[model samples]
Target: MSTDNKVPEIRSKGFSGEWAEEILGDVAEIKTGPFGSTLHAKAYVEDGHAIITTEHFKSGELPVDKKNIPQVSEDDYLRLKAYLLKVGDIVFSRVGSVDINALVTNKQEGWLFSGRVLRVRSGKIIDSEYLHHELSTSRVKKSVVSRAVGQTMPSINTEILKITPIHFPLDTTEQTTIGNYFQKIDALINQHQQKHDNLSNIKKAMLEKMFPKQGETIPEIRFKGFSGEWKNLTLGDLGSVAMNKRIFKHQTTISGEIPFFKIGTFGKQADAFISKNLFDEYKAKYPYPVAGDLLLSASGSIGRVVEYKGEEQYFQDSNIVWLKHDGKIDNAFLKVFYSMVKWSGLEGSTIQRLYNKNILDTEISTPERQEQTAIGNYFQKLDNLINQHQQQITKLNNIKQACLSKMFV
Candidate 1:
C-alpha cells in the first residue's frame, strides 16, 4: 500500500515493466447523460426499456430482474440512443460519490443512463475492464476527489473526467489477468452475501413460526414426540434481576488490565478499562453473571442481549443487568426466547426505558427441558453458519481492498 509507481508492486507472475499512463480523454470517449428535460419522469411506463440511475449501480453485477425498474417507450429509447449503454462501458457518478463507478456487462446493454451519470467508452488502445480496475484504485479515487467542485455536494463534469489520469499495463493479456482475478474475488464475496441474506430470512421466519403466538398454549410448529402444552410463566418466577457493583468514573482508564463495557459498548469492543485487581474485587463482591448468562441492556437500546462467555470484563451497573436464575430453564432456549420476549410497560411509555419491574413481569411460554434443548440446539447451529459466512464476507472484502491498493499504480 505504501508503494507509488507506474507499475503495481504486486502482480501476476512473469512479464513486467513500468506501466504506461495517459489522460482518460486520450484513451476513451467520455459522454454525459441526456439532460433532465429530455427525459421526464412522466414518460416512464410499466413495461419497456429500462433506465440506469445511480441507484442501479452496485458493487456486484447488475441485477437482471426488472421488478421495480422504471422504463420508457420504444420511441423514447431510440430518441436517447446516444445515452444507450453498451457492454464494457464504465458509468461514473457525476455528483456525490464521484469516485464510484460500475462496469457495464451484457446484462446492462441497451439501457439509458440518467443525467447524473458519466459514461466512459474505451478506445481500441485501452481495455475497458482494466480501466475499471484502475479507476477503482485509491490513488485515482483521490485524484478525482481533489478535482471535484462544490463544497456541499461534490460534482464532476465531462471535461474533468476526460482529463483524469490512469495507468495500465501495456499488454492486453496482463490487463485481462488482473481484471479476471478481481472478478473471481467479487463473485465469491457476492456468493457469501447471498447465503447470509437467505439464512437470515429463514431464521426470521422460523423464529415467528416455532414460537407460540399470543393466547396460544402450543407453537404453530414443533418437533415430533413432544405433545403436551407449554407452561406459561413470568420471568420473576425464573429469576431476579442482578447487576455489577457500581464503578465510578475515576475507577476506569483508557487502557488497563481488563475491559469495562458501558451500555454503548455492551455487545461491541470496550473503550474503557479497569485494573485487574479492581475487576476481581468487584466481581467477587457483586452478583456477577456466570458463563452463558444473558446480559441485557436496560437503557438507550432496550432489551439488547449478549452472552457473558466468561470474559474478564466489567459492565456498567443499572444500565446493564442480567437475570440471576435457577438451573431449571436452559440458557440456550432463553437466549432465543429473548428475541421474541416483549417487556411489560414498554408500550405507551414516553421515556422508552426497560425498568426492572417490566422485565420481571414479562410473560413467557416454555416446553420441557428435553424439547427446550432440541429447539435451542437447532437454532444455535443455524446461528453458527450465519456468523461463519459473515466473517468470511468481511475477510474477503479486506483482501479485495488490500489487493486494489497494491495491484494498481
Candidate 2:
C-alpha cells in the first residue's frame, strides 16, 4: 500500500512507465495560515476580500459555495497577503478533520486562507489536480490522518504535511489525462447535486404555498375547480394515534424472523428482530399498520413519516405510532401534511415529546378529498424525481471511489 510501488494495479491504456515517488515537500511549497492575532474577528467586513476556512473544503474542491464567506477590508487583506490563495493551490484543515483537503480553482484565486488551514501550492513537477485526486485516495487520507497529532482534536502542521509521500506518473500528459477523467466524473456529480438541490428547493416552495398559513383558511396555491375555502379541523376529527402492543427486551433478538424497528431505526434498517411465532400472534391481535398507512416517528427525530407497504415489520410501541384514521383524507395527502405539521402541547406550548393528544388536537386546514388527492399526487411526483437524482448521485460517487482506488498507487 506504500507509494514506493511505482506500477498501480490499474492504469489507462498507452501508459506503461513506472510512476515516480517523492515526498510532498520536494514537489510542492507548503505554508500555514495566519495566526489569530494577525487576523482578528473585528477585522472582517461586510464584503471585501474572501478568507477560505476549512468549511470551504467540500468534496475535495475549495470554496464549494462562496456565499457568506468571511471577508476582510482591503488594508487587512494586504497585511495578510502572505496567506493569499492562488489557482491550483490545495488547502487542508489544520485542526479537526485533518485529513480533508481541497484544490483551489480560478474562482478562489487571490483569496486568503483562515487561521485554521494549511496551504500547499504545487511545484512544476506534479499536476495540482492530479495530486488532488492522489491525496483524495483512501490510502493517502488514512496516512495523513494517522500522522495528525492529537487525541481529542487531531491537527496537522506544515512540517508533517511536507513529508507526506505522493506517487504520480512521470509524464505530465498522463497526469493531466487521469486528472481530467476524474474531473469529468466530479462535474457529473456536481451537475446532479445542483439538480437535487434545486428540486429540494422547489419542493420546499410548494410545501409552503400548498399549505394554509397560520390564521388563514386557504393556501396560496391550489388545483383547478377546487376553489372553495378549506375546512378547519383538529387532527382528532380525522384520526387517533394508535401503536402496536409492546414487545419487551427479552422478546427480541439481534437477528430473527421479523425485523423490529425502534425509534432509532423507524424509517431505516432494523437492528432488532422478533420470532415468526411472536410476529404472527402480535400482528393478528395487536394494532398493526396496514398497506398505505403512514407510520410516523413519535420520538427521536420527531415527525419522520413513512408510508407502510404492508411489510412484515414490527415497530416499537409509543415511540413509533400511526394514526388509525377513517378514509376521509387520502393517505398520500396526510403523508405530505405530516412533513409540515408543528406539534404543540396543551396550553399552547411547543412539545418535547409528541403526546397522542398533541397529534390529535393539532389544528389543520384541509381541502376536500378530491383536491387533496391532486396535491398529493403532484408532490409525490416531485419527490420521486428528487429520489431518482439522489440515487444517481450515490451511484456516481461509488464509481468515483472505485476509480480513485484503482487509478492511483
Candidate 3:
C-alpha cells in the first residue's frame, strides 16, 4: 500500500511499465453537486427527473434503475445543470467511512447529483475507468480519509479529495487494459449473481405454491399427475426429535478424531473436536446425527436446517437439535419442507427460539411417499445449481481481489 517507486508485484504479460504517482487534482477536474438546501426534500417526487445521491452509487458504480430515485422538478433540474452528471464523470461519495464511487455513462448523463457527491473528470492523460478503480482502492482511502474526517459524519471533502494521491500506470494502454479487464470480470460476477438470485426467488415462489397455506388442506399448485389433498399432522407425528450429545466447552479440543460442531458450524465445518474414546462413550448412550438425520440450529440462529451426511462429527447439545424421522416421512422431503416451515404460536420472550416441544407441535402437510420423493429430488437439483452459481461468484470475486491487489501499486 505504500506509495513507493517499486513496480507492482504482478502485471499483465508484455507490460512492465513504470507507474506515475501524482496528486489527483493535477490530473482530474473535481466538483460537487448543489447543496442540500438548494435541493430540498419537499421538491422530491416519486417519478420525475431522477437525482443520483450517495445511496445510488454505494458499490462504486451507477446502478441502472432510475425510476426508484427521488426526483425534482423541471425548474430544479435546469437550475442544477452545473451539478448534472455527464458521460465519463467518476462520482464519489463526499460523506461516509467507505469511499463509494460511480462512473457516469450515456444512460446517466443529464441526471442531477445530490450535494453529498463529488464528481471527478479525468483528461486524456488518465483513463476514466482506471482512475475510478484507483479512487476505490483501500490503500488510497486509508491515506486520504485521515484528512477528510468530519465531526458528525465519517466523511471526505473536496479539499482532501483534490489532493488525494492517485497511483496509476504511465502507459495509457496498460491503464485501458486493466480497466477493460475489470469491466469484464464485473460483468461475469453480475451475471452469476443474477442467476443465483433468480434461482433463489424461483425456489421461494415454488415453495409457496407447492405447500399448503395456513388453514388449507391442499396447495394451490402441484406437479403434473399429483392429485388429492395432502395429509396434515404435527411434526411429532412424522419424526422422533432428538438432541445432540452434551459436550462442555472445556471437554472439547482444537483438534481430535471427531469433528465437534457448535451453532456456528451447523452447515459449515466443525470448529472444535472430541476424542474417539469420548465420542464412542457418548455414541452408546446419546444420539448422534447419522445419514438422513436433519440437524436444526436451536440457538440464536434458530431453525437453520442441515441434513446429516453421516460424517464423523459431534454436535453441541445446547445449541443444536436433531430430527430422526421414521420411514413415514422422506428425509429429502422434510429437508425441503424445513426451509419453508414457519414455526407459529411461539412466544417472543428473550431471543426468538424453537424448543424441542415447539418443533414437535408445529403442523406439517405431507403428500404420498412417492410424490414427496419426486418433489424433494427436484428441489435438491435446484439447490445444487444455486450452490454452483454461488461458488462461481466467490471464485470470481477472489480472482478480482487478487488482480486488484497485484495489478495496482
Candidate 4:
C-alpha cells in the first residue's frame, strides 16, 4: 500500500483523546549502538553498571538479574557517556529478532547501552513509554522490518529509524493517560506470570517429597499401613520395552492410514497422528499403540513419558520408546515418576536428549499398587490446578495482543 493511502487516519470516534501526526522532527536524536565487544557478564564486574540488550527488554520492563548484561569500567563509561541510556529513553533491537523495544524505567537507572541495541531520545515531544509502545506495535514492526535490508542477518540502521513515522495524541495529557493505561495492564500480566512461576516451583518441591529416592520406599501409612517393602525394579523387568522399527525409506508415503508421531508431537500431550493419505500400505505394518499405553522418548529428550489417551497412533523411528505395561504397573504412576526423576545422568546430543539404555537401566523404587494410586492422584490434582492457571494466562495474553493491534493503528 502507498504510504499516503496506508497512513492510519486519526479516529475521533470513541476516543476522547486528540490524535496528531508529528513528522518525527529533529527534536529527537537516534543513536546507534557502539562496536564494543564487551561480553554481557563482563559489563558488570567490580562496581559495574547494568547494560541493556535485546535480551534484557521484556514485557515493558528491563529485568535486573539478566545473565549476559555487560559491565563497563569508569574509563569506558566516560568514553561512551554520550550514548549511555537514561531513564525514559527507549531502547530497541536493531539487528536480530528486531522490534523488541522497552522504555528505560527507574529499574535501569544508570545502566550503559550495549552494541546490539539502539537508543531513542525525545526532548518532551513524546512520552518515552508511549513511544516504546508505538515502536513495538505490530503495525510499526511489520512496516519497519519490510524496509530493513540484508541477506544474512537483517538490520535497521539509525538513518532508517529516523524517518519511521509515529502517531500520537496531540495533547501530552492524553499520551500519558494512554501510556499509563497500558502500563497497568502490563503490570497485571507480569504479576500473573510470576504467580505461575511460583506454582511451578511448588509443584517441583511436592514431586520431590512424594516420590521415593533410590533404595527408599514409602513409609507405611498409619491409616492404611502395609507390611511389605516397595520393590526395586528395572524398566525392562516391568514390561515389553521396545523401540519402534523403522519403515523402509522407499515404502514410506506422505498420507497413510496410520498417523506417525515425531518427538515434537510427543512433547505435546498428543498421542495420535492420522495418516496424511499419502502413505504406502506396506509402511503401516509396525505395531500401533493402543489407548492407555505409555509412550516414552528413548532418544532426543529421553524419559519424557505420556500416556496414550487417543484412539490409536503409530510411532515413528525417531528416538521414541513405547512401554506397554502389564496390569501389574499403573501407567499414571510411571508417568509422574518419570517426570520427577529430573532425568539426570541421561546424555544426548543436546540438553533435552536422552538415551534408551541409560533410562532402562535406571532403577525406580515402585510402591505397592495402593500407594501408587494415592501418590498419582495427589500430584494429578495439583497439576490440574496449574493447568487451569496456565489457561487463564494464555487467555489474558491473547486479549492483550488483540487490544494492542486494534488500539495502535
Worst 10 residues of 3 by lDDT: 1-10
The order by descending TM-score is: 2, 3, 1, 4
Candidate achieving higher lDDT, 3 or 4: 3
lDDT of 4 at 79: 70
For model 2, the superposed segments whose C-alpha errors exceed 4 Å read: 1-5, 254-256, 346-352
Q: How does each model score on lDDT?
A: 0.87, 0.87, 0.83, 0.67
lDDT of 4 by residue, 1-409 (tens): 1235333333334454334555443546788776655444445565555566666774546775535666667777777777776888888777766666777777777777777788888768788767777777787777678877787877877877777777776566656766786788777777777777888898787776666555577642312554466788877677666556664545444655566676776645444444444333323655556667677876666667777776444566646776656666776777787786655566545646556556666677778888777777777777777787778778777876776665655
> lDDT tens string, model 3, 1-409?
3446646777788887568888998999988888867888788876678888888877666767686788988888888888888788988888874466778888898888888888889988999988877776777777777777777777877778888887887889989998999889988998998999999999989888888888887888888888888898988987777887678989899987899888887789887899999988998898776788888887777779888888777888857887766577888888898888877765457877778788888888999998899889989999999999999999999998787787789
Query: 265-356, model 1: which lDDT tens digit per residue?
Result: 88999999999999988888888999989999888688899999998899999889888886668888998888767676763355477878
Worst 10 residues of 2 by lDDT: 344-353
- Who is ahead in TM-score, 1 or 2? 2
lDDT of 1 at 62: 60
